[model samples]
Structures are given as C-alpha cells and as structure tokens.
Target: MLRIFVIVIIANAAMAQVPFLGTCPNLEAMQNFELERYLGKWYEVERYFAWFEFGGKCVTANYSLNENASVKILNKQISSLTGVATSIEGIARLIGRSDDPKLTVTFPSLPLPFDAPYWVLDTDYISYAVVWSCTNLGVLNVRNVWILTREPKPSVAVVEKAYQIIDKNNISRAYFIRTDQKNCPVTN
Candidate 1:
C-alpha cells in the first residue's frame, strides 16, 4: 500500500503544469551575459507545454529596463481558437552576479508567493536564445524551457543552432512543441 501511494503521488506531480521528475539538472547559466544586448523582443520558437499558455499562439516576449534597473517583461500571446490577444506584464531582477544570466521573474497578476527562475542557458543576443528554469522540490523537480528567436519565423539554420545548444546541455527534447507564428496579428 505504501508503494502504491508513492507511485500515485509521483504520477500526479508529473501531470502538473511543469514537468516534474528527479533532482534538478546540473546546468550553468550564460556567463558574461550582456543585459543591454539581451533587452529586446523575442518570439517563442518552441517551448515545453505550460498550462497558462494553453491555446496560445504567436507568443512573444518584450524586455526592457525598468526605472529601478530591473528588467521589465511584457509577454503577449494570441489565442489560436478565438483569435484574441492577451498580455501580461512582469518584472525581473538578477539573482546573482551582474554578468550572470540568472534572474527571478514575478508577475503581479499571479498570486504567487515567490518569483520564478528565468535563466538563460545560452544566447547570441541577435538570433536565438535558450532559456531554462528548474526548481528542486525535495522528492521531485519542476522544469521549463523555451527556445526564442528575434523573428517570428526564423530560418532553419537559426532553429538548428538553438537545438544544438539544447542537445549539448543534455536537455530532453521530448516535451518541446513548436509555437505557431503564422498569421499573427501585427503590432506597431
């Protein structure tokens, strides 16, 4: 009975919004990260499934500097079914050294007790970026990943480069799904 209970709990946690498994992976954030160069719009090329992003398409995130020097986050997404556009604003601040690409992001719209990790695993600032986050929860860990590009529809070479980084990091590609960027509503 105890074994059965443990199996059930693990199964339930695995079905949560974020993928949960063993301890968090040993991954390093980008070193010598330039905040100024990374501050711009990034379109979602691919990502792990997220409940809050269900039915969302043409997802994009815009970053800028806030008055307090914290990074401002503006995430936008359009509904594939309803064609409705929605967005959320958030704040991000470095969690480590100035050049470290590790940060914590908080959305005032969500009633969460703490900020979520937003770590840039790799990036070239101009073409592509691989972002990853993991939280160790004792018996299990929750993980998230996103492959972003400066353009909504990046070339094959650009995407392949992003995949190379993911492969090098040994991150599983099973959960990634391409984001639909076709017929997206234009913004000025």
Candidate 2:
C-alpha cells in the first residue's frame, strides 16, 4: 500500500508541466508593452508541432492591433511538399490578459482551434523576443507549439530554460516537435 501510494504521487508530479508566465529572469518588465508592442511580425524559431513541420520552406508572421483590443495575428507556414513550396495561413487571437502584460493565444482556424491555447508564457525586454506555449496544445493533439524572434534556432541552454519554465507552470509537453529549418540543428 505504501509503495503504491508513492508511485501515484510520483506519477502525478511527473505529469504536472506548465509554462512560466512570469516576468523575465533578468529584466524587470517588458518594453513597449502595449498590444501594439506585440504587433508587426514574427517568425517561428521553434515549435512543438510534429505533424506540421508545417515549417521548413519559409515561415513568417504578421500582426496588427484590432479595435476589439485583440492582436490580429496572421501566421503563414511555408513548407515544401514534393519539391513544391506550399503555405498555410492561420489567425490567432489573444484570449487571456489584456492589461496584466501576459497573453494567452488561441487559433480560430485549425481543427481543434480553440482547444490548444497558446500562452505568451514569458519574455525579456532586452532580447526583443518572447516564449510561448500551450498547457493543452500538446496533450490534445500533435500540434502544440511555441513561436519566437527570427529564423535562427534557439540555443541548447535556452531550450533547457524554456523546459524549466514549462516544468514549473504545468504546460503540456507531449508530442512536442522542434523544427529543422535553416535555423535549427539536424534532428532526425
């Protein structure tokens, strides 16, 4: 009985993963914090979507602040299929946090659209970039993800750090897939 109880506790502990929605480790607060600050454009540095690699080719993002106080996000995923580059566009809206400085994002076009909510988990004012995740994205499907600054892939240390944040926040991590575009290491 004692051993079974201990196993259950350990199993629960292992399954509790989340993202860090707190402030940056070295920075005090985000810069140009207005929703406009999140506007303009962004590229997928790394994501957790496996079936989509929906990456590769050339991926870019565009955003505009909407009148409803939502960030109008336009994500274009360009990938080569059988030597032809194809693109898929997606629209994401901020669901949680309007003034708290944090944002939880959701896509209204995908199959499970509103299900895998992407949270603008955290960021650093100094780096001009941010970290994002979905506590339910991965667990729900094979399309959970994260977006970042540019085309260049993140460093090993950065990946570990992001994992740490997710570990502490109970974010989903299943079926996570890192891309292999011009910016990432060759992981087959």
Candidate 3:
C-alpha cells in the first residue's frame, strides 16, 4: 500500500511541468526562426543568477552542435576558492518550439523533475539570451535566465549589449549574478 502511494505521488509531480508547456512567452512573433544556426559554444557574458553549481563562481556553458540527436553540454565548473575549472555532461533539446516561433531546451526528460528549462532567443544573430522559465506562467518567473556568446569572455561592450537585450525583455538586472569567470575562456 505504501509503495503504491509513493509511486502515485511521483507520477503526479512529473505531470506538473513548467508554464507554456512548450512555448516561449512574450516576443513570440519574431522574424526568422532557425535552431541550428543558434547552436554553438557560447560564452557566458552576463547571467541573471548563478545557476547550477555556479552559485558564486564564474561559470561557462560549453555547447557543441551535433546533428545526431541531443546536444551535449559541458557546463564548466569553477571553484570559487581556488579558481579552478570542472566540467559536467548534460543534454539540451528543443522542447516547446516544436510548432511555434519560440523555443526552449531541457535536459533529457521534461516536467518529471518540475524544472524543465525553456529559453527564448532574442533578436540577434551572434548574441543571444535565453529566459530560463520553469513554468509557463510569467507570474512565477524567477532568476534562471542566461546570456551567452561564442567567445569565452565578452567585451564590456558585448556584455552591455547583452544586458540591454535582456533588459528590454522586462527582466531585472539586479537579480542577475555574474557567472564564475575565474578561468576565462580563450576567444577566436
């Protein structure tokens, strides 16, 4: 009896997913729409909040574009104490943008964890920011967003540029914490 009850609870949790289920909020109607061109190793320019293991340290998200299936991510880990680098393996797949102009990507499964991450690409070719939304409802939107670039460390201009893009979206800049950058990446 106990086992059955536990299973039911788990199943219910999985059913409850982030808002919009599979759609981007606000600025949904953009001009061009392409996912492949946007996939690449983007440097962390400015982030709303230190996400994952990068609470206080500078963090970078290394994404390699693949044609096979899921996109792999080496979310570099930085040690705030000693200023070191570590890498973790993760996958991202377009979940919500299936039939819309916007898109959101998550790890493997969706909802079950109740933290399905969705990113809406702003208007830009090289620079792009993803508004990390856990639920479809904007009322509960928190600081889980990210701004990335092709380079490891962005120039002050680029950083500001990204910030402007995010700012235009109604996101608060004060809440955003810089990703761990003790070990900055090399640029092209």
Candidate 4:
C-alpha cells in the first residue's frame, strides 16, 4: 500500500512539469515559410521558459543558411545574475522537404539527442513569429513556445495576433513568461 502511494506521488510530480499530454490537432506549422525572409536576427519577446534557459535575459536567436543548405542557429543571451554574454550554437536540418518550417536541431554540446521539432506555428516573416515544439517524455509531452520579433518589442496589436496563434495551438497563455529586453546593455 505504501509503495503504491509513493508511485502515485511520483506520477503527479512528473505530470506537473510536463506541458501537455497527447497531440493538438489544431496546432499546425506555417504552410510556407520564406527562408530568405526568416534569415536574420530575432529577439525573444516572450516564451514558456525551458529548464535550459533559466536565468537568461535579453535572449536572441540569429539564423543563417550554411553552405551545406542547413540552417545555423545561434542563440545568445545575457545572464541576469552575472551580466555576462553566453551563447550556444546549433545546426537545424530541414525535415521532410524544402519550404517547410519543420526542422530538427542538434547541439554538439548536449549529449542527449537535441533532435527536437522546430515548427514555425505562425510567422509574418517580417515582424513576428510564433514557434512551437514538443517531444514526448515517457507518457507526457514537453512543449516549448516562443514569441520572437524582429524588434525588441513589437506593438501590442501584433503581440495579440501572436497570442491568437498560440491560442489556436491550444497552449495555455498562463505559462508564458515575458522576456526582459528593455535596457539590455549588450549590443549586437
């Protein structure tokens, strides 16, 4: 009886950290994403904080096409605690076909497979992009959502549209944490 009780407690704790269970049929990636237009710097306006990104502030991602036709992803951030610049580089392989926003990123530093889905859920190309990714962990799904913009802060209306896209994906808005890009001492 005591062993069963312990198992129940462990299960609940695991569930609490998991983002969601099962698939979201309504959550769809962009039909067509222009690679050229998306090739630039993007500031992280908001996101559902992943464990790896804890204590990171003024985060930004820069994308460029490599000679091998893969996308080079450079993620940079300032440590909120120590105020130092830190970065990680990853390469994203285009999954399935061209023009599709689905990708799988692999980081050399990480031993565990970094081959996670990189889906562009919604993007205007020029201004804002809503990206989503999910992977099954045991019986539950761990999800990551990011709201990125060409500028540090997009207009409220633009952000509202991004939120609508997230809502359509069935992600709870309560989980989002707004990134602090204001007064970031670091420059490009």
Candidate 5:
C-alpha cells in the first residue's frame, strides 16, 4: 500500500511542467560545431533558472576530451544558500557523429538518472556561446538556456550577439538571471 502511494507521488513529479515565457517548437541545434575549439572553460554569464540550479552564483563549466572519446563536463558554482563552493562532474557523448553539436549528458551518480540534451545553438569559440535544451511533458516544456562567455564578464557586444540568437528562438530574456561574477574567492 505504501509503495503504491510513493510510486504515484514520484510519477506526478516526473510529469511536472515548467512554465515558459513563449510558445514555439523545439529550436534547432547549430551545425558544424568545432569540437576541439569548443573544449575549454566557459563562464556562465546568464541563464534561465532551473530547479536544479536555483540560487547558484559564479557558475562556470569546464569541458575536456576524455579517453573514451566523450567530453568530461565539470560544472562549478557558488551556492548562495550555503555560501560554499559546489561542483558536479558529468560526461557528454556525441549523439551520432563528431561534426554535430547535439550531445547527451549524464551524471552516473544521480538517482533516477537520464540522459539530457546538450545542444549548442550558436558559438563564436572566442567570446560567447548560446546553448539550449528542452524536455517535453505532454504539451508543456521544461527548457534551459545559457549564455556563456570566455571570461567571467562579457562585453556588451558579446552579450548582444547572444541575445540575438535568444530572440530568434522567441525565448524570453526576462527569464534569464545574470550570474554574479564579482569578487569571487580565489580557488587553489
């Protein structure tokens, strides 16, 4: 009896829908992404908040090629709630081929784990990048967007370029929260 009730609750949570600012079909992923050039550190300048990443500040992602031909993803953040640094490591594998920017990422240590899309929408490889991913729940959508930069803070021009791609997809900029990159503690 208790087991059945627990299953029902978990089912409802799995079917939860995230509120979005605009209506549109899934945006297309960028093509011909340079795998080597894209492998590096990227600072999260802004992002649309997700439940798993709420209250995270000074966020950054480091990507490196692994021996298995997959990419190792290290995501680091400063937790506002606990005032501590936190990080998670995951693996990203190319979906079908090396030329495409579409990939799937998974955290093996996470419970009830699943592979999630990690699509690159646009990138300059020098200054900024725009990434988008979404999961469908019936007619609703749960999506995430990230504006990443080569530096902790990006120039206005760099940010504007990313915004153009965001606007093209009809993703509301209002949902994006600017990540705090000021006066960060030095890491050894």
Candidate 6:
C-alpha cells in the first residue's frame, strides 16, 4: 500500500511540472493552410501556462516572410509587474508539404538545441487562430496551446466561435488562462 501511494505521489509531481500527461492527442492541422493569409500580427487571447512566458501580459506574435522563404516570427510581451516590453525573434520552416500548417520553429537566442513544432489546429485568417504543440516524453507529454485573435480584445461572438472549435477537437479549456490585453503599451 505504501509503495502504491509513493508511486502516485511521484506521478502527480511529474505531471505538475508538465502541461499534460498520457500520449499526445492526435489533433488535425488546418487543411490547405495559406501562409500568406496568416502573416501579420495575432494577439494571444488565452494560452496554457508556459514557463518561457511567465508573468507576461499583452502577448502578441507577428509573422512575416523572410528573404530565405522561411517565415520570420517575432513574439512580444509586456511584463505584468514591471511594465517593460520584451521580444524574441525566431524562424519557422514548413515541415512537410507546402500547404500543411505544421512547421518547426527555432529560436536561436534560446538554449534549446532542437526546433519545436508549431501546428495550426484551426484558423480563420481574418479572425482567430488555434495553435497547438506537444512533445511526447515516454509516459508524459508537454503540451502548449494558444487561442489567438487578430484584435487584441476580440468580441464575445468571436471568442465563442473559437471555443466551439476547441470543443470540436475535444481539447480541454480548463488549463487555459486569459491574457491581459487592456491598456498595453504601444509599439512601432
């Protein structure tokens, strides 16, 4: 009995550090995804807690075409406590097919040695986007999800639509936390 109790405690501790457990869900990426339409800025409305983005508010991601045909990604966030802004640049390359919404993103500034998956589960270029990434580690998985909108503060209808899409995919909305977009500092 004590051995079983110890095992359960260890499992819970491990899961507390990661985003999700069990095998990564088999979610589908957006079909016929158009990179051109997805370019420009997207404000994060909600997201799973990410260690890299701790204490960040008014998070936004901007994408543009690079000279080498890869997509250039710029993610900016303001410190909720300090009111200072910070940004990071990364490069994303299409993983398989040209139209696939799956890409590998590499942040050269970070200590990570390998590229991470950036998968678009669903998006309506003019309104909202759902991005998901998961890395399976044997018994547990590290998952990240972001609900993005073209506008910093999206309308209720828009948010409901995004939530409906997430529901269709059976992704839990429990772990997501809202990102503060009010009174954010303006940027060039």
User: In model 2, where is the ten-residue run with the lowest total lDDT?
Assistant: 134-143
Instruction: Residues 126-185, candidate 2: write the lDDT tens digits.
Output: 223445433422223122446465334556665666566556555556645554456322
Question: On residues 1-188, what C-alpha lDDT tens digit does candidate 3 reach at each position?
Answer: 99788766644433442212343445433345465666566656555433345444555566665676556666665677666666666666655444333444454433333335546545354765554454433223223566776655667776777667666666566655666555554532
Q: By lDDT, who's the top model here?
A: 1
Over all chains combined, what TM-score does candidate 6 have?
A: 0.88
**In candidate 5, what are the lDDT values of residues 79-168, reduced to their tens digit?**
888888888899999998788998898977777567887888999999999988776544445677899999887899999999999989
For residue 68, give model 1's deviation from the true position in Å: 0.9
lDDT of 4 by residue, 5-88 (tens): 866754643443335666433467888777778888999998886766777888999999999999899999888888888999
Ranking by TM-score: 1, 6, 5, 4, 3, 2
> Could you tell me which 10 consecutive residues in candidate 5 have the lowest summed lDDT?
15-24
Estimated TM-score for each candidate: 0.90, 0.52, 0.64, 0.86, 0.86, 0.88
Query: Candidate 6 — which pairs collide?
Result: none
Candidate lDDT values, in order: 0.87, 0.48, 0.53, 0.80, 0.81, 0.86
Query: Candidate 1's residue-wise lDDT over 1-188, tens digit each?
Result: 99888777656445533756579888867789998899999999999877778889999999999889899999999999899999999999998888999999888887544577899989999999999987776678878899999999999999999999899899889999899999998873
Steric clash pairs (candidate 2): 17-170, 17-171, 18-166, 18-169, 18-170, 18-171
lDDT of residue 80 for candidate 6: 94
TM-score of 5: 0.86
lDDT of 4 at 65: 96
As for lDDT, the candidate ahead, 1 or 2, is 1
Is candidate 1 or 5 superior in lDDT?
1
Return the lDDT, model 1, position 33.
93
lDDT score at residue 183, model 4, on the 0-100 scale:
76
Give the C-alpha lDDT of model 5: 0.81
